[model samples]
Target: MQHSIPPGGRVSGFRLAKLLGEWRRRGARHGSADLAAAVRMLVLDGRLPAGTRLPAEREMAEALPVSRTMVSAALDQLRAEGLVASRRGAGTWISLPSGGALVGGADTPLVGSSMVDFARAAPPAIPGLLPAFDAVRARLPEQLVDHGYYEHGVPELRRRIAQRFEARGLPTSPDQILVTSGAQHALALVLRMLTGPGDRVLVEQPSYPNALDAIKAMSAIPVPVAMTDTGWDLPGIAAALRQAAPRMAYVVPDFHNPTAHRMDAETRAGLADLARRARTPLVVDETIVELDLDGDPLDGPPPVASYADDLVVTLGSASKSHWAGLRIGWIRASTEVVHRLVSSRTALDLGSAVLDQMVLAELLTEPESGLADRRRHLAGQRDVLMAGLREHLPQWRFDRPGGGLSVWCELDAPVSTRIAVVAQNHGMRLAPGARFGAHGGFERWLRLPFVLPPDVLREAVRRLGLVAAAVSGGGSVPHQEVEVPVA
Candidate 1:
């Protein structure tokens, strides 16, 4: 693939410090190595993209409150690794992150590679998927009679999606649905329609990594409200909505990503009222709501849109629910909003893949038990993961998530970035907690996906234990350059 260099942009010293959160390890004498490791992780994660200019050592030292000598040492290490480059007059900037191919855990094997993809919280296609495809193939003859373009999605698929919402206790119509390439694509359209550069978007403190990337890419600021131990902090969200007066609020109320917290009905009602009062549309992401492991998704709390339909823009995807290969997601909102989105969407693409939409529509027609098998499989894998964690790394702690695909593990030490840096050698790819945070500070947290097979999950956890132990022991792991994919 051809690449275009991003225009050089300089990051502020204080901003850089925030991005490199909690870099120093506990009881560590020298912070230089830790600082370098943190920076390396950020660059590899695309947090600090190539062509991004860095603050001078003295400025960075003032922001970090570390000695200039330590700052110089960290820069030296990064420069030696070629992760960063500096010139006499040009100062320092990030080098392009390329070369050194590493295997990734793509569900369908995107390439010839081998590694446990612990970062992506996605599962393979369900057992019913191929049958759904065959069903679509049988009906394909008539579908070929007309032009395949569906700006508002195939009508039957849209109706099926609306029916799912009704099952979840939300009154949705086919008019409210506008299908797109994926949830990420749906989000981009919403952002383009509702916001402009410098607009504020309310978001959870630790959000979906790609969502955060989308918000930043749009040049809109993210106003984050921290999550409590139990779930969302409604008061905090209300305060942000009032003070920030953001253009819109992006939320994952159902089986929230990484943390896997589902909002209660009462809280959902309160949030809807808050958004209504503030006139801020809540962009609710229910991409993984169908993956409810504890109970039926329909039996779960009512869809947040039910509370304030006009104040909500719901994004749904078949990626996590049925298959990522489908790449089909849709937006549900007021008909006016849907129409506006369609007007703006033509600049992006014509419509989602017709065949994929048909497959999902077919799957949606199946009984609720169609997804029961998926939940059971995930629950069993979750059990395998928790058991492995207890056996190999008992010190790590995480709450049993009732739904969603991952376990949010809290490390005994502030070494998430360290653990990730070392895990590559163990043939495991892990997403550090910093990826979830808005400005990067969850050093003690890591999100571990249980989407892999039972045996793979068990082995992944075992390797993770070794990685955690190595980092905690303060033994230096040799640098192994590889790409870190964010899902």
Candidate 2:
């Protein structure tokens, strides 16, 4: 195939050489699997437009200083995957399948059927949950022989949860709490009670995608405010409040999802003041506050709720701190708001499972409950995982978050979806960054969960490094030699 360099451009640098070396190494070890996966992802994510001509094998190999054989293998793999097609004297070109072509046909069912998913933000169930369940079963006969299923949740559970919040500096009363199945359910009920179709609500950019979907499903418009690496963009948020005049602002103030940036007390107070001034309700998701990985719990500032008033709707859950299977989460608000939510919840489900509520109450009230141990375990795991990433892929940029389940890493190039696809082929599922964004930005980011065991995390990062090198066009070399760009 004949090729010419793009006008006013020339490719020559150590960067080019490193990219080629990385690609070659990945091809030799993984046999063009990663490169092909990258090509397919580029097509799938619309980064490489349909009919875009690919560089010739010999030219790419020469430019990158790799063997033509490796380039040929990569091209062949792409051809086999139907992502690219070659014609006589035309070289290779991308071919994107239309939306209808994604499934077997237009009639194929693809919406609700379960696909291999790594996008969920919740953590795996803890081992202690089973014992808690057994204990609940043993004590159920005495607790539930006389029945009362009302909206205030189980009395014992409410008191225990309120006490836990109080310990964190968020004053609460049993009458102000209403338990729901999970955090998502709680958020849904709150939205149902507070807002309606055509109402405007504020959300953060790269916010929880499922929550965005929920808002859309309810016919509400979501106004996005940007979040920075340090924390919430208070100026931008205030501007959005003024411009959008949203009915409510949903925020993940503690150990936020996707970015793991916690809002400081000053920002929290400022936001509360803004909400109060604008007459906008603020919904705070504190689901991950108990997952702190840095310092002793005694060192951190008071909980976010300590800075807000009746305008704030604080949501907490046992899912992240304890076990997701427990399906126990609660909303803390004024008594009036609690009653409104409870009344609205009656149409959704009769009540949360009595057994699970009782189990959570018992667990939270335990003198030596499992929270401290779990925190210690998570802290150890986070260190191990971060160390692995630093050792294996130094080119990527990431923040060692204070507390959260995942690390948000930014790749040197906009090829994270490709890397995820390649990793999945090697038996490692990844959450691509675009899944976190509202309008499909963040193509250069990926979320890696550090909640896995150290050994498993090591393996995952090793495979991930291999994938990153391949996408970066770096050929075979030790991970230490790979030039991963932090920016």
Candidate 3:
């Protein structure tokens, strides 16, 4: 019954150190200034968010492997700048200089106006969406006569969504579906059903930030398994399953976020077998499954739920494939699990928006048909963003994402947070690498979404290159595309 997130989350020393990556430059001099700048970056980036308690100086110093004097000096500098507020007993927490959020704050230069939002990796509605809505409107009068509450979602939508699974070579029944507001909402319900406070949940090392926050919100611990060069670390996951005995494992095997790694059918089978042996529920998120930029998503690997019918719970969303504005997503589990989810869902909300559900039903009535234009559109944007990245910020290295909306870039320097903070002032917002980490690591990584128009993407990356140069203390990048070699 208690659902409110605690007043604030207390970030530990080790986690704080990980958040502040290779904060100090090559030369160790001016440690205080460097540390202050790193903390300032985290605060401004909203990674260290307001009301997040900072660890003690001694603990932070030990974790940062720096002198206590340096830590004190750094905090003093931050306090002087009005970016931090502290008391003898209350300790320190993040605070804006002008007592407002960085975003839309009067004194802050971030996202003031005409800002290009690179943080959100989603696209506009498809052309077919308007027609879908028109189709729904023709039938809205009939639906309005009903009770207007579907704890298990509208029947038409459930059937349409279920048929999508069948097209992907995974048999699904409408009775096995439970629709919700979105995938994030679906995940929240799953967490409520499967986990309790203090229970451990297995997750990818650099997993989705929102998912990580969800786990922590439940007071459950996240047991992370680092991803390998190729894909999932099977042996490492197996070890964690044995050691941690987590309640459930949440993963995005289909075009994973941030890294954009797709799991082959073989890996899916391996993961299913592992979950079977450990008796852990495999919660698979297939949000961006239909965004296969290279080939047909239908012809790709089978749904993860097909590998272990009874043990797997699949989450799907039209937000990525179609449009987030639809606000329609669902859960595909066994009949019993679906019933249980619906039973628990009443505590949250009665159902999703009826009109949006009807529109999605109309869109998915011809499943792959509506998604083709979306894929083609995203592919063009992906190519443009990739080309712009190579031309403008060649010091960064990133693999071509087979699918998904973003490019997972590995910067030459561990300045992802620094670059993100600087980018805010450049009329572009960025999510730093550390935000994806369970304990705030991944300093060399940053996820750049290619969801903007080709022209907008070009301008955004142009500004990004400048931000990178400024952070590295280099000269301004030329407006003309110049490919620099990445060592």
Candidate 4:
């Protein structure tokens, strides 16, 4: 089974530290108040779920750039607010306010410890991944002499990625590629390099939440263009570009997240034309392109770079196609843009892990068969999930996504958040549609990922059915409340 954090489980201190990204600046005070505010926000927003253990004071101080005194003070503040608890032998864990007034409604159920988490959209590693490591191990000795720090990535990996793009009709040179930790990191580099605070950035209405977060983190204003149930609103996007003239427009053209709507070739060309005229760089995310299960013998849609190579910057990842643990993703852009990213990358990290890049290179050199195998697996899982939703929860309407990991499902009532709240109480975790919508749209929808195995998907759907029923019943079900003892 894929690893998931149980509702009352504790994630590693390192993981918690990462979740507290750039939190020091949120409050005017750089010490305890700011740290406390950040932790409180995380707990309230459900990112740091209740019952997750916070790192020890010293550990947190080491993980973040704060003193142990500040960490202790922050914990004290959280304790006073009932957002944290401590046991004699146990470390501090997150807690919701008593009565759940700050988070959900007072009657809202505390999420059970046995909840089946559906928040992650990643799939398990493919079968060949283990053996691929041995392939890389054999070549490790050949490169031991060098210092092993490569900001532009291992040259061989860059060449292989370029060839992969070339095969897809987007001719690319190795210099055009800059490998990063993952797609999110690539996006961060792009956002930092291309846009500044107060600059307008265009994004899909219900786009990737992390992408929106990244834009917000940079303090760039996001101009959303609505993407309907059918597909991209071309005219609407055109209008946004014309009016906003955004510094950058980010789009997931192939197998978009939440909504698995792929932009047609004509629409891709139109977007390219528009971006070209506006002199705006189009950031096309192709992380899910290889996931197409439309039953076509051909490969997925051509890269947006093919539409206008000069105007479009493309992001691709081995995470979606092969495995996420590898942490290998790249940016394919103009050589000039690549140079800028390379120069600015040291501010983020020196480079990606070299060994992971080598493994991805091997995978890329011979990926068609492995890709076909994965597609078959995902297709089977998708079908099983769809069948379960149909049989168990027919009222939850969804489009059969042609490609990508999740299906954007619509509900009759605008209670997606309420359903998620209730589902959390009933041992199921859900990514509410409101999480995807920037302006509180998609309130009637949910993004259900079918990447899990058939049996697991069926059981998850069954649990979700219980939540759906409780939601549709229009009566308050008494929730079993877990009272957390304050620190």
Candidate 5:
């Protein structure tokens, strides 16, 4: 059962004001677009959970330092898109999609509005990314005269990506690197190229949802090997490989998503050996490899590819460690695999964007210092999120993640999806745990990202607590009261 805000209640002026961060810094034309885009992004992203009351136009304008006209224009645009609805006396409220029609579509509002989103597991673009883009703009003229297609990737980018692997103790060459739009694209390409219909693929339980979707899109049977808060089950994985004999295995070794379990060196070695024996090529997603916030700063592990050079296909991306907007990712594999990916990619698209590639190349050439800065920023945010959760939602439980963007939380009731639904009414967006599992499991879990600033995160958790209370009959159920399986 979901609860609604009392009539005439308005969203806090402070929260509405925070939504205008940096919009004024851009100038009026850009400011209006930025303001509208931020609000639209919030609604679509489920942060402005359905039914959240919008601040009065005057209130918003006063708080954000924008004119009333700009605020009205933004609101009018939102109203035209059906993301907001207003009445004679009641204020405007956020609306949800109707009959699968997204926010920018149908004229009808499905539900109400929300103001905070905990669904996004991605980090904000670093303050330094803009400077990198400016540098790339200066260098753009050098490459613009030539034909702007490089399926294998720009030479400098390939070299930098390969050099990153080499720096991490896995020797590589530019010839072994094939750049793609992002890790998801790289994973999709690998799945398409390697697996045929009816082939079996091994994956971690509670794996990245998009990766699971990619496997299913290929019509490949997914054999999930269970992972825990501790790490992967080596024997179980080995048995799955032996039993299912999957053609390919996809694993996220460092700072795994959802669970945030990093594979130990021994487990990595065992999996590599198992995959090699099964002749199964492991597609390792290392997007979060450099985000090791808890480890000794100097004691970084080598790439898993270092152990099984012949069998592992390593995927690297600028998304997790760097800015995702750059949309740059690469695959480091055998030269033969690289060649095949290049040939197969034309069927998907030409190469990545030229400007993004150049920008990423500059970022990769000097990544460690930037990654360190990111680690510190994330660590602080992570603490804030953990502390907030402890204070507001004391009944829920989650192990502290050493790295990665989210905390995989365990709710007391088997109502993770229900909680998510009820949360929308309270202006919070959440990803139900079932989305992460290959099978319809994890109904008692949810992945909550600590990517937002401290104050926003505190508000999100506070809202989550309200929804959790509603779902749990005014109190959290004890773990012994329910026997849900952990992923």
Candidate 6:
């Protein structure tokens, strides 16, 4: 039997035959029920997703060495079960039924649980984490014996965080602070407090995927405002706000994830103005603000919240700057907004861990704390990864991101998904660019983290180079001769 595999899915005709043959060998009936079950398992296991078009009956029958009658019968059975749906002239599509319609049994592998996941945006832990944990242990007794776990958050920690923000030029008050487990939780609390389900929210295109997921989880509509390689498209953002009339907008102004573009001062001011004009709340994620990898870290400009007090919510997290396991994050907003957020947060974990907040407070107040060590370590790692990429896979085009954990690279071809699969086979994980975009765009790009150690990053790049060569159908070539400009 011969089958024509889809473009992105390179499962060959022979492979399909083998899969079907194995199913037959298991003594399952060769009818449509059995075939539908097999295909359902594949879809549920993430090998296929909704809207994936199956081959034509003639093509599938030829590939499976089955009669066309059998192919048609199997498809009909699948359609009846609502596991597959067909449209006239558009061909048949495999779709999971909406809500509570369980087609497969408990033994089937779940969609996200079965893949070799590289879509995570988390950075590796700082080298100081072990020592930080030790330090936390030395002071755990007092925290454990404390009676009340909720004073909003530990007082000492809140004070320290406020002081740290002040040192960075953003004046904050401890009364305006509320600690949370992570940035995601903080964002959720803010969303729940500010807007209701079905309210519209504006987000940047090719932004953080988890933000989109959170918005959708709240049943909010996410209107994506396109951004550019140079910086935020202020006019585009304004247009999106005007058209969508969103209740809020989420912006990652400093060293944005996936894109690595920083919002310039002028753009920041314009955005604040835009939000004020639109009467929409603006949430700025400053998680990657302090990770400057380029020249001298000049405190560039005031935070967006500083520009517009009533309409902006500034969020910060120690996860990116310090350790993800620490799970400490805060929001610096007006007292009114802080009170509302805290009120909404009562149902969500009753406040953050008391001991973790205390530890963060100690780290923030210490003159030569783990935060300083983290900054220095990340700078060195970024340099190491950049140098390795320069020496190895220079055909890929990427800028030296000024301050961010990852470098966004544009490949010559739209094969990021393919390259990711091949790299995983070679023991390297990769984030395909499409995962960062809505409507499955950014197919020609990749996001590579420089947060790993020098040696591990070097090895990963070597493996990535080999995978790129394989995907490109060419042998390794000499590094492209280009001047390495200081970012």
lDDT of each: 0.82, 0.69, 0.82, 0.77, 0.76, 0.69
Worst 10 residues of 4 by lDDT: 101-110
Native-to-model Cα distance after best TM-score fit, residue 411 in candidate 5, in Å: 1.4
Model 3 C-alpha lDDT per residue in residues 370-468, reported as the tens digit of each score: 577667767877888999999999989999999999999999988877777777678877777888889987879989988765556777788899899
Q: Write the per-residue lDDT of candidate 1 for residues 397-435, one digit (tens) a residue.
A: 999999999999888988888888888777888888888
TM-score of 5: 0.75
Model 6 residue 140 distance off true place after TM-score fit, in angstroms: 3.9
What lDDT would candidate 3 get against the real structure? 0.82
Cα TM-score per model: 0.76, 0.71, 0.75, 0.74, 0.75, 0.70
Candidate 2 wrong stretches, greater than 4 Å = 1-118, 296-299, 474-487
Residue 296's lDDT in candidate 2: 52
Cα RMSD (Å) between model 1 and the true structure?
19.9
Q: Is 3 or 5 the stronger prediction by TM-score?
A: 5
Q: In candidate 5, residue 293 scores what lDDT?
A: 84
Q: Report the error of model 1 at residue 217, Å.
A: 0.8
CA shift of 207, model 6, Å: 0.4
lDDT of 2 by residue, 1-487 (tens): 1121111122333323432334333446775666666555434433343334566676766765557886688778777766666666645555433331111111111212212223444544443455567677888888666765756789899999888777777788999899988888898998898789999999998787667777887889989887887878888999999999999999997778878888777888888888888989898888887877776543566665576667988888888887777788999998999988887888888788888898888788662346666666667767877898899999899999889787888888887667766665555656667667766678788877665545445655777788788868844323211112110
* Tens digits of per-residue lDDT for model 5, 123-201: 6554445557778998888888999999998899999887777777777999999989999899999999899899999
- lDDT value, candidate 2, whole model: 0.69
Q: Candidate 6, after superposition: displacement of residue 258 in Å?
A: 1.4
Tell me the lDDT of model 6 at 245.
91
**lDDT string, candidate 6, 1-487, tens digits:** 2122221122444565564555544333566666766666555433443434567788787887777887788788877767776667756655456541112211221222222123444544443344445587888887777674673678888788788667767788998887888888888888888777899888888888777778888989888877887879889998988888998999898889878898877888899999899889999998887677664334666778777878888888888776677788888888888887877777777878876776677566562344455556566657777787887888888888887778888898987877876765666556667667755578788888765434455656776788888879954433222111111
- Output the TM-score of candidate 4: 0.74
